[model samples]
Target chain A: MQAKQIDYAKEKRKSTLGWAVAILLACFWLVLTLTPFVFMVLNSFRKQFDMLQQGVFHMPDPWYFNNYVEVVTHGFFGYFFRSVLVVAVSLVLMLIIASFAAYPLARMKFRFCGLIYAGIVAMMSVPMHVTLIPIFKLTTDMGIYDSLKSLVGPYVAFALPMSVFILTAFMKTIPKEIEESAEIDGCGRFRNFFMIILPLSKSGLSTLAIYNGVAMWNEFAFANTFLQTPSHKTLPLALNQFKGEHALDIPIILSVLTLSVLPMIILFVIFQDKLVKGMMAGAVKG
Target chain B: MASKTENKSSLAKVRGKRVAVAATVFLLPTFLLIAVYFIYPVIDTFVISTYKWNGISATRTFIGLQNWVNLVKDKNFWDAFKHNVVIMVFSILLQIPIGMLLATFLDAGGRKFNIFKIIWFLPYLMSSVAIAFLFTYALATNGGIFSSLASLIQGKKVTVDLLGRSPHALFAVIGVMAWQYTPFYMVYFIAGYGNIDTTIYEAAIIDGATRGQYVRQIAIPLLGPIFKTACTMSLIGSLKYFDLIWNLTQGGPVNSTELMATYMYKLSFQQFNMGYGSCVAAGMFILITVIALLFQKAFVVKEDY
Candidate 1:
């Protein structure tokens, strides 16, 4: 009985130790993730002199809120709005086109369904830069170059393959009975897709939207190459100019970076579960 | 009854035509769009790589295999390829393992760990440019946090030129890339671990298996497919990596941080050497294809269950 009691105590101690170690490790990663953002936000409120005098870790003396005001007043908001518009338009179009394509491929029996799906999955493997030069030339040749509108077509096209593949994978899991019941009620193919499949695929569609939105919003290569004008620039390109434009105004630059990064962070917090689910579904299963 | 069968067969034929029509209507727009914009551009990249031409000016000189020949001999191209290989190595080494470890911890962490999962994933949500900028400031020579920390530790003022210096530039880029992407793998592996049957864990414990043995012997084996998938993703992404390097270093002070994508961009856009740029891109495409095909053949789990 005494030995049994000792063993029970030993087991409890081991588990407690394990718990403590896990918490410590978790906290370490938490600090690592949150520190940069905290540093960015905190340092954004400190002036260059203050930062230079008292290291980056120090709190701001007076907390200069004007840094943020300056960003908005100096046309950073235009870049912000431009990014929003571009991502919004691209997301909407990608959902529609990819869904339309995916519906037929997933639901209906077609001769080339396998071929088309394979082509899309293959397309996903081809990096954006491979086609960058050609698409740059193609857009320029067509005289649609150097405009925000120029970004829309390519963004949608690039977003399609993955979106379609994810949605198709999702739609495949959906029972055929749902569509069959709709068909029995005298609904045509297009009508059934519109009223039934489209509604049913909301989770999948939103998942694709989150994935594409995050990507297109952060997409620097195409935006940087295509939209050259300052007014036409997206948030990323504008942030890039922080190096040249602001020189070494560290706080101001941080403020601008904060501005650019804030929206996505907010969106992420709001749609955290959906974003996680979407990314997992899109990536792993794909 | 024979007449009724004939009528039903005609009706079925009409439904088949309608299905065909609907499929075409559904498939046509995305198909046409991808064909024109996506497909043609890839094919055109191959054709353009064969000639010597500026990005503009219709006067094109056909160099045949000359550009391709130059690519084989190009030092910068090879250097960039080497950098890509390094990135792939580090990503597999650092990113996947760390991600998997965190995922395992978070899986066992329970509801309290949910908040930590969200916090950890915050980096993956932000843009590469923003993340790069944040890190650049943190690592900058003057008044940057990294330098300040080093100065404090060494008892003297010191500045590390992370993005500017050649020796440190590539590693800095890799570090940042790993930092940004590790969370993704964490989330991915979490979903993977969640799929494993919990009864197996209970069984193992009942059989007197230690925690280490349970995770190592059983969990790791079960996660084989996910591990392969993550590795392939890391490999392909590393090979084609550009944006972070471009924004951070622009392949930097003597091309230390150059990768295939950045090199291709520099040649095409910066130097106006569209033909050579196309060649580099084609090389990247071929490399990526070969790697992807090899991974698919070798590591992809054969059984669905």
Candidate 2:
């Protein structure tokens, strides 16, 4: 009995040591992760020249707010709103079209169902860079270059493959009897989709929305390529615009970075659980 | 009886036709958009690669395989590709293992560690462009975080030229990429661990296994498929990485930090070398597809566990 007790004590000590190490490493990483953010947030409150005078870690002397005020007044919201508009329109269209495609691919029997589904899924690995030049040409040729409308098509197209993939997988889980009963009541495929299948796929659609919504919001390559006019630019390009204007003013640029990242951080905080769950849904399936 | 059978057959044909029409109507928009944005563009990229016209010009000359030949021999293009490979290797190496460690820590600690999860995930919330700009200032030579810390320790001001140097720039970029993406893999593995049946853990404990032993033996092995998926994602992500690098360095300071995407961007957009840029982009696409396929074929197996 005494020997057994000693073994128990030994095991407890070993685990405590493990826990200590784990906690130390976790704290180290925590510091590393927060340092840059601390730098960004802290320095944003300083005067432009004060950043150079004071240490990076030092607290702001007067806690200036003018940078934010200046940024907001200088069309920051225009970029933010344009981003919101583009992401909203693109996300809705992507979800609807993806669901439409996913429905038949998931539930119906068509001649090219397997082949078409495979084809769409295969496009998941095709990098967006290959299409960059041609899409640029297409945009300019269509006379929609430098406009928000040019972004919509590429956004929806790029998001479709993965959304369709996930939604199809999600729809496959819906019991067939639900759709079969609806069919027996003389409902056609269109009505069945609008009333039955679409309603049941709410969780899936929301997951896709959160997933694709983030991508569309932060999209840079296509936005950088297609939009040249300052007003048409999105949040991703806002930093470059601000940097171009305030070439030497580090605090103003930092404020712009902080402002551009603020909305996402707010959304993340408010919808933390849903957002994590949504991302997990994509990760597991993807 | 024959008349009744014919009537039923005709009705069945009408139903089939209606189903076909519904399918067509449902699938048309997705296919149309994809055709315009994805399929046609890829084909057009290859076709444009054979021409000598700038992206804006109305006139074009068919240069045929000359662009392809130049790309094959181009030192800068190959150097960029090598950089991509380096980043891919390091990303998979650093991000996955570190992320797994963080996830394992959270999993072992359970609900009490939720705060760590939330804090660790904050980096991912910010867009790459924002992070790039943030780090550009954070890692600057003068009045930067590192220099401040160094000055405090060494009793003198010390500047750290991370983004401006040649060899150090790529590694700095890699480190930043890790900082940005590690949280993603952490959450991914947390989900993987969550998917594991609790009964399995109970079973392991009943067999006198320690928590450490159980994780090391069963949990990690069970995560093989998820691990493979994560590596594949990192590989492809590193190969086509553009946004952060573009905003951070623009593949600069003597082209030390160039990747395929950045190189292609410079050529096509900055320099207006449309034909050659098309070739490079096409080359990158082919390389990524082939590498991803080869990775899947090599590592992805039909595992029962």
Q: Please tell me which predicted candidate would have the highest DockQ against the true structure.
A: 1
Tens-place lDDT digits, model 2, residues A94-189: 999999999998987768889999899888888999999999999999999999999999999999998898888889999999999989999878
Worst 10-residue stretch by lDDT in candidate 2 chain A?
Answer: A1-10
Superposed Cα deviation of residue A8, candidate 2 (Å): 15
Give candidate 2's error at residue A236 in angstroms.
0.9
Docking class of 2: medium
Candidate 1 on B1-305: residue-level lDDT in tens? 12358779898777768777888899888988888777898899999999898988888788899999999999999999999999999999999999998998876654557888888888898788888778877778887767887999999999877878888888888888878999999988887877777777667766777566777999989888788889888999999988787777888879888889999998998999999999999998998899789778766455544
Model 2 lDDT at residue A75: 94
lDDT of 1 by residue, A121-144 (tens): 677877888888888888888888
Interface CA RMSD, all predictions: 4.8, 4.6
Q: How far in Å is the alpha carbon of A214 misplaced in model 2? A: 1.1
